[model samples]
Target: MPEQGMVIRGGAVVTAHEIKEADIWISDGKIVRIAKDTLPKATGTTVFEEVDASGMYLLPGFIAMPTPSLYKRKEGQTYIEVMREWVRSGCTSFVDVLQLEPWMSRPQLEYQQTRHFNSPLDYAWHLGMEAAQLEGRTVARYRELGFSSFHVTIRSPEEISSIQWETLWQLSASKQTIVHLHIQNDASVKQEQRDLIRQLWLDATKYWKVRTVIADSSAAFASREFDPFLHIFRLPAETTDRAVRYMYQRFYDSCPVASPLQEVRIDCRRRWCPPEMLLCLLVRLASTNIAKAIGLYPQKGSLTPGADADIVFLKKENWLTKYDLSTILNFSETHLPTSVMSNGKWMYRNAQFHLSIGMGRRIFDTKPNVYVI
Candidate 1:
């Protein structure tokens, strides 16, 4: 007997490129077909539940920026509560950055894996380490264990100078690991010194040909010496300055190269950018860009056939309303997902949740398509 499936009919499906009305056919946790005029008949035991989406817009579920833990039960919150909020807000997955101290054992990794078994949203992990760990095959061993992304925090220019750039870059490039260079410093660190460190790191990464993501860095957009091997992740704080925001917009507009310059923050309440622009930015950056950065492209962040059926449905009336600073302030409240689906199953619908604790799975062994976006 064929398995049960679903047909989400008459919704305007939105992608990174365009929005079109289509019926999404889902089976076995994947989107098997998407068509406008007709759908195939369900025969044998392949029963398909038809969902009326006549006045809704379907979006690929949002993938959040890298965070410490998206699955673990937080203080004063149960796993169900955390997941419910995430699904209601249209977020289906995120990259969890596992900060590791030196000399941690593989048992630690095993424990982290256990923590995600109950997660409702799919996720991946980025190994966060200090500069000292970059010299050896520390990254390679983790890659062997199914990790393809690693982030190194450089707090000072001295830290950048101390890193074994050659060894780190060679290993990363050879193993196809996405290296995130996060250059953050304390208030005591002078702006000049901070800028110098950013320059130094950029120079080194460009020279070494390592695929790198410069997280929370706006200066990368201002600099004209753009490298194809480098990606920029612009956070809300970094984009608050109008001048920096203008530079980012210009870079995004003019840069013909596909460098995957992406934004990690989407502030729905902000009036700095026009509402329409902000909405478009949210869809592109939050969903599509994060997926590409984490190497989970069409599979996780898209509605194309063969992609996972993790989807969020929004009411057309709410999404198409007039936008202004006052009305948009409650944007999130207004745009709460009407229904949410993960892996071809409806987890949230009609203001109710149908959750299973161990529904989510870990995404690993990814090869990032940095240049795709």
Candidate 2:
């Protein structure tokens, strides 16, 4: 039997490169077509439903960057409430960073899975393993279990030498495994030490050919050498010279911006970037770029044909008066999404939720091809 069909019309559809008025046709949880004219109705077992988007801007639903504690239920916050906040802020998918200690067992993994059973958003897990945990077959073992993304924390320069880069490089060269490096910095660690660690990884990319993402390390934006294999997750603040250099370097092609909505909201309030730039950054960071980074590109981060029908609707009233493309600074406050859909179904609409406890599923179960860009 065919899944229900849907036609979302009367709105401007935002794509990776452009925004234009279009009607979206959906069936079986995937976009079937997008056109300027109304699409034909479904026949047979498929029942077509029409959603009048009227004055809205249809966007690919926001896909949040790696959230370290998203799985841990916070005090005074129910799991559903936690996920509901994401939905309220327009996130339809997210990447969770799961910390796995060397001694943790399979049950620990299973427990993590159960923690998100009530999630209203689709999510994937990036295993957080320590430097010592990278051993013979360890990455391969996790790869078999549907984890291709791994993160490691480096607090010192010596720690970089201890990592089994050969094993990671081999898997990356073979299976497109991604290693996310978080170079920890504080009063204890000198700026020179951090720079050395970044330089070491940058130098390693010359020979090892390992796919690596520098997580939340803004200093990477100032690297003198550009390595195709090295991607940075942090986007320098728009006020900084690094942000200008970042764009001048065209790093957006390979470096996806990683930020949670709260930080984005704060940035907006600060008016650090012009609203137009912020909107573009939001779509790239919150949608397209992160999707590509996690290997869920066109499927999760796009609104084109064959992409998942996950979307968020921004109303016409939210635009700033001066700039046509500018979204108001209080976007999260005054312009939260009017509706959100996941897998072609309405998860949120008109200040109400239509989500189920287990409706959200792990994306890796389908085994998406690893996208190197």
Candidate 3:
């Protein structure tokens, strides 16, 4: 019998496939029950905190993996300030994408320590790789130091052949470490270069048996043609209605056949895409698919029983009613989460953070699981 528990009642729970009215009971930092009917009276064995979630949508908290093309830190800004901005946007998890170099060791450690001591959100690190870093014992050293994933940036065909592909393949295969490829804008435009990129993905997935991802830094790649593979798109810390419009436009341009309503929605009185499509793009692909690509699928991306209780509660009326594109987009982009729960604890409520600074943990995928191809 758990000593502490909470029941969130009467909210429409949004799962990956469907949204249904359900009551969620959380205990010990995990979801314990999702009941369609009202729960029976509790025996005196458990102390329960009850929350009314009527007229709200209870969804998994957003997870962001940001990769800045330039590594310049904003003047006078601290990592905690950056994380607080993300938290205000309903993001619960972050993965710091870094460039690989011996000189970066100190700064990376300092960043990790700062996040550990000042931020109130979970975080991880993904290191960008260089050919020299692929030499003897370097990859092993990263694994020992708790680096979560490796990133590879390809600018030209010569660079691809220059890398010791076989070595990276074997290391990733043996350790199940995720390898992310950033095919730069110029390289992605050429036919021959695109072919090479596809071939590399085949080798990584088929021959090496390693989980791989196509990391899109600028979001412009969403409007380009590329081989079918797992993709992770970067999102700004504090998003806005204009940004949402730009993102939807990119997706519409890239996959017009897939989204047949692009023309009608774009030309509608709203002058932007439907809010549902934006939600699917930003929440489903950005948060859930990225989680799956990084091998943190069911644990971080889902709200099923037994998963971590990282949740965001949003007012249904803000998004479901008839409104202009700017109005609807603001619900998700500009408006803060009405309430947020991390690890079964109330971290944010009534548009304010409730958790203390440094309360969040550093999360990583220590045990890599099999990914469906």
Best by lDDT: 2
The deviation in Å at residue 336 for candidate 1 is: 1.1
Q: How far off is residue 80 in model 1, in Å?
A: 3.3
lDDT of 2 by residue, 2-30 (tens): 66799998988876446778999888899
The sequence of per-residue lDDT tens digits that candidate 3 reaches over residues 204-276 is: 4545455556443233233343323333333322333333455465553322111101111222255455555
- In candidate 2, where is summed lDDT lowest over 10 consecutive residues? 236-245
TM-score of each: 0.86, 0.86, 0.75
Whole-model alpha-carbon lDDT for candidate 3: 0.60
Model 3 error, position 218 (Å) = 12
Q: What lDDT score goes with residue 22 in model 3?
A: 91
**What is the C-alpha local distance difference test score of candidate 1?**
0.69
Q: Each model's number of backbone clashes?
A: 0, 0, 0
Displacement of the residue 334 alpha carbon in candidate 3, Å: 4.5
* Model 2 RMSD, rounded to 1 decimal: 3.6
Candidate 1 vs candidate 3: which has greater lDDT?
Answer: 1
Per-residue alpha-carbon lDDT of candidate 1 for residues 227-336, written as tens digits (9 for 90 to 100): 74465454443352332344347635532111222223333444565433445455665677667767888888789999999999888777656344242233344568
Lowest summed lDDT window (length 10), candidate 3 = 255-264
